[model samples]
Each structure stands twice: as structure tokens, then as C-alpha cells.
Target: MNNILNIVKHIEKSIIFILIVFLVAILVVSVVDFGLYFSRLLFYSSLEGWYEPEFLMPLFSSFLIVLIGIELLETIKAYLKDDSIHVELVILVAIIALARKIIVLDYSTMKPEKLYGLAGLILSLSVAYFLIKSAGISMKLRKKSSVDQK
Candidate 1:
């Protein structure tokens, strides 16, 4: 039984390793793609006009995509270290995803209610993130105080 359990553990570790490697590859590809796209946008803007406001939204969206990938990588790292997923990290990823949407929003076409919905979403995520961080800090302080008292 122990040998079978050991085998299972090894397989799990191997799968995680492969996943990490794939994520790193994805991260690299995303960064390279962002660079290429931004350069092309800049080159075209330079040739056509001194300023192009339209390209800025796409650039920010791409940048946020890269950031989301990075946050996933961090979540994986945290899981490997502690064998648990961190809620704060997941919330952060969601916030980044929502921020990306807001950043790329076409104000001319979007409805006012949709804008209000997005604003509410951002506010909720901000509050959740703050509460989680504060809870963690309080827990750590409690643990330290208890240890000192003992």
C-alpha cells in the first residue's frame, strides 16, 4: 500500500512539473507576442501619425493578459510550496482580468448600466482583497502573540 501511495505521489509531482514548464513556455510566448505587437503598432503610428490613441487600448489589454499569466504562475508556485491554493492570489487574478476589461471598454458603444456593473465589480473585488489581506495579517499576529505568551 505504501509503495502504491508513493507511486501516486510521484506521478502527481511529475504532472505538476509538466504543468509548470508549460506555463513558463506560455509566459515567454505571451511576452514575445506583446513585444512584437507593440512594436508594430508603434512603427505604424510613427509612419502614419505622431499619435494614435486607438492602439493604446489593445496594448493595455495585451499587457494585462501577460499579467494574468504571471499571476497564474505565482499561484502554481504558492501551491507547490504549501500544497494549498491562496484565495488572495485568485482574487487578485480576477481583479486583473476585470481591470483589463474596463481598460479596453469602448465608452462610445457601451451602455451606462454596463459601466456601472463593471464599476461595482471592481469595488467588490477591491473590498474582498482588502478583507482577505487583513485577515491574514491578523492571523499571523495572533499566532505570534500566543507563542510569546506561552
Candidate 2:
């Protein structure tokens, strides 16, 4: 049984490593693509087009996608090191993703209920993140206080 468990663990780690490699490759390609697109937009497009929503929205969205990828990579690396998932990091990634969605959302096309739903989601995630962070800090403080008493 122990041997079987070990084998499963090894397989899991191998799969995770492969995922990391692929993620890194994808992120590199995305960055290069963003750079080329940006250069074209800047040098080829007119000055008026620079501030246009159609052009700027995609550009910012792409940038945020890259950032989100990096954060995911960090989360995976941390999981590998600690052998546990970090709730805080996961929540943070969720918040960033929500922010990206909100940024690129077209308010004109969106319904009122949809907007309200998104607002609720944002509030829930924000509160969850705050609570998680506060709990971590409280734990650390308790540990310190206990050590001081000792």
C-alpha cells in the first residue's frame, strides 16, 4: 500500500512539473505576442487610435492575462514546495481575474442584473481575502505572544 501511494505521489509530481513547463512556454509566447502587438499598435496606428477603447482594452487585457499567468505559476511553485495549496494566493488570483474581467467588460452590452451579480462576486471575494489575511496575521501574532510568554 505504501509503495503504491509513493508511486501515485511521484506520478502526481511529474504531471505537475510538466504542467509548469507548459505554462512557462505559454507565458513566454503570450509575452512575445503582446510585445509585437504593442509595437505595431504604437508605430503603425495613428495617435488617435492609441486612446481608443477597442485598441486599449485588448492591450490591457493581454497584459493582465500575462500577470495572471505569472501568479498561477507562483501558486503552483508554492504548492510544490509546501505540499499544500495556499488559500490566500488562490483568492488573490481570483481577485485579479475578476479585476481583468471587470476592466474588459462592455457596460453598454451588459444587463443590469449581470452588473449587479459581478458586483456581488467582487464583494464576496474581497471579504474572503480580507478574512484570510486577517486570520494569518492573527495566527502569527498569537505564536509570537506565546513565545514571549515562554
Candidate 3:
């Protein structure tokens, strides 16, 4: 019985260690990719004179920014633990969600009342922006020094 208990404890520790290592590796890779995607956006803009893009630049770029931003915030959250992970993400996701809504807005399907609701959503998202700034719950939270974690 004692032998079995000792083996279980060892297994638990090993499993936890493996999970942490996996998470750290994932965070490192995601951060690297985030940097790469940002650079790609810049490089594309600089090479605009050399080639005309087939896609809508603003649309794709905005979408890319949203994706990159979320990944960045998530990666930070994983490496640097915080309670505001979802809060920080929701702020940007709210903006991105609204942008996509505006981009694909179906005027015919939306009634007058629904338009008011959509507009309200947009207003709320704007308010969220101010709240995020005022709340001091962004990169500040995500990148708080690991030393301060204790």
C-alpha cells in the first residue's frame, strides 16, 4: 500500500511537470508566430508598389490584427499568469467581433429595431475600450513581472 501511494505521488508530479513544459513550449512558439505575422503585415505594406494584392487589404489586415492580438494576449496570459486574461481578451475580441459584424452587416435582414441594437452593441464596445484603459487590465496585467507573482 505504501509503495502504491509513493508511485501515485511521483506520477502526479511528473504529469504536472510535463504539462507545464508543454504549456511553456506552446507559449514560446505562439509568441514567435505572433511576431512573424506582424512582420508579414508590415512587409506586405512595404511591397505594395511591387505587386497588387488580390484581397481587400483593410479587411484582411484588420482580421489579421485581431487574430494576432488575441494570440499575443493569450500567450502572455499563459507565460505570465493573471486573473484578467479573459477580460483583456474580451475587450479586443469585442472590437473584432463588431468590425466583422459591420463588414458583413445584412441590411435587408436587420429590422429598424435590430439596427438600433447593433448600433448599441457598437456603442457598448466603444465603452468597453474606455473601461479597459481605465481598468489598467491589459499588457500591464499580462506582463507583470514573474517576480511579483508571489
Q: Of models 1 and 3, which has the larger lDDT?
A: 1
Candidate 1 lDDT by residue in tens digits, 52-95: 55757778888999999999899878767665677788889999
Ranking by lDDT: 2, 1, 3
lDDT of 3 by residue, 56-150 (tens): 44445555555655555564444344423455466566667666666556577878997888789888878877787788856434434333354
Q: Candidate 1: what lDDT? A: 0.80
- Which residue runs of candidate 2 sit more than 4 Å off their true CA positions? 137-150
- Model 1 / residue 72 / CA error / Å: 0.7
Error of 1 at 128 (Å): 1.0
- Tell me model 3's lDDT, rounded to 2 decimals: 0.60
Off by over 4 Å in 3: 1-80, 83-86, 135-150
CA lDDT of each prediction against the hidden true structure:
0.80, 0.84, 0.60
Q: How much does candidate 2 score in TM-score?
A: 0.87
Better of 2 and 3 by TM-score: 2
TM-score: which candidate is best?
Answer: 2
Task: Put down candidate 2 lDDT per residue, 32-120, tens digits, no spaces.
Answer: 98999899988888868567799799899999999999999988897777666777788889999999999999999999999999999
